[model samples]
Structures are given as structure tokens and as C-alpha cells.
Target: MTEQGGTCAIPGDHHDTAACEHISRMLARISDKWTLLVVRTLGNGPRRFNALRREVGEISQKMLASTLRDLEENGFVSRTVTPVTPPQVEYALTPLGKEFLCPVRGLAEWVVANAERIDAARASYAERRAGE
Candidate 1:
């Protein structure tokens, strides 16, 4: 990567600074912990707000709401409301969201597969640091 003006440009890509910034912002949003968990949960199928909240586990209602709003605004998730009685609200992943899941699942699998190795590495690093 090379710095052009104030933005970093990829070695071969032609995106401008503004486009790069937008991509960075989007990657940050989708890579957030809450967003990842929510997307993974929704990948199972559409879910009611309460069901989704329950399945995601440990995420506060407020945080889930904010995450959902952000995902919907960015076109990764869709929200549907049925106007009956108290009304039913559901959230589901868009096609883009589903496509995004491929890499997310791959990362999750890699981490799971290497968790023991990672733990050993962390322990080794800590031992070296303590000796210093």
C-alpha cells in the first residue's frame, strides 16, 4: 500500500480516497463483535426480535437494537413488521449478508481449529514478557 494525499492506496486497485474510506468504514461496521454474532444468528433463518435477542445471548437489548439498525441501514439485514395485535417484528439477513457469512464462518472455523495452538502461543508470550 502507498499513501496518496491522505489515504492509502492498494498496490493495484483504482479506488479513490473517498471510496477507500467508505470501504474501511463498512469493514469496521461488519467486523464488530455484535454485528458478527447477530449475523451468524440470523443466518439460521428469520427471527423475531425477542427470539433473536435470546439466541444472540449476552447482548443487551439496546446494543442489539443499535446493531440491527446499523445492519439494516447498510442493506445487510432486512426488518419486517406485521401489523397484527401488538405487531410482530422480524429480522433476516439480506443476500449480501448471507454472502458475507462465508468469510465469517471460515474465520470462526479457523479460530476454533487453532484455539489450542493460540492458547499455547499466548502462554509462551506471557512467559517471555514476565522474564523481562
Candidate 2:
């Protein structure tokens, strides 16, 4: 492995460096608290604006709107508008977004499986800090 831009880049593969950079950027975008929650919520199916707001609980209207816009720009979600007297907007995971679920769910499962160990580690750190 070679290090580039402070990232461990795999060697001997022509695309490895570029691929690592792309994956790093994608993870930065999707791993945010709100983004992950939004992605997971949309995994259920397409949802209207207000419905998404309600389901993603505690997200401000402003933040939700911004998140959806970003996701749409990234090709992870699609925004559809229904032509009616009152235009209706719905958001759904695109195929790319759907493929992202595997890793996201893996993260969720990891958190669940390690909760106790994490808590214990935190407690040990606290005890050490207290002694220090």
C-alpha cells in the first residue's frame, strides 16, 4: 500500500488511488448523521417531503430540504414532481442509493453488535481519565 494525500492507497492497481479518493468522498457525503438517517428512511420507498420530515424525526425542515437537494445532486436519490394544481414532490432512492444499503446496514449491525463493548471501553477511558 502507498500513502497519497494522507490516505492509504493500494498499489499495483491502476485505478486504486482514484478509486480510494472517490470512495473517501462518497463516504464523507453519506456517513453524516442526517444523511445516513435520510438514506435509511428512503430505503423503505419513495416518500413525499412532509412524510420524510415526519419519519426522519427532529430534522429541521431547512436541513431536510438541503439534504434531499444534495442527495439528488449526488445521484443517490431522485426527485419527481407530480404535475397538478399543487405540484407534489417525492423522493426515492435511485439504483445507486439502493446499492448503498448493504454497507449502511452493515454499519448499523456493527453498532448493535458492539454496543456493550463500546460502552465498556468508554467507561474504562473515563476511569483512566479520572485517575490521570
- For TM-score, the strongest prediction is 1
Q: Which pairs clash (backbone N, Cα, C closer than 3 Å) in model 1?
A: none
Worst 10 residues of 1 by lDDT: 1-10
Q: Model 1: per-residue lDDT, tens digit, 4-23?
A: 45544465565567677777
User: How many residue pairs clash (N, CA or C atoms closer than 3 angstroms) in each of the candidate models, in the order given?
Assistant: 0, 0
Clashing pairs in 2: none
Q: Estimate each model's TM-score.
A: 0.87, 0.86
Q: What are the runs in model 1 whose C-alpha is more than 4 Å off?
A: 1-15
- Residue by residue across 1-132, what tens digits does model 2's lDDT show? 455565534654544777778878877888898888999999999999999999999999999999999899999999999999799999999999999877888898999999999999999999999999
For candidate 2, give the lDDT: 0.89
Per-model C-alpha RMSD = 2.7, 2.6
Candidate 1 lDDT for residue 97: 90
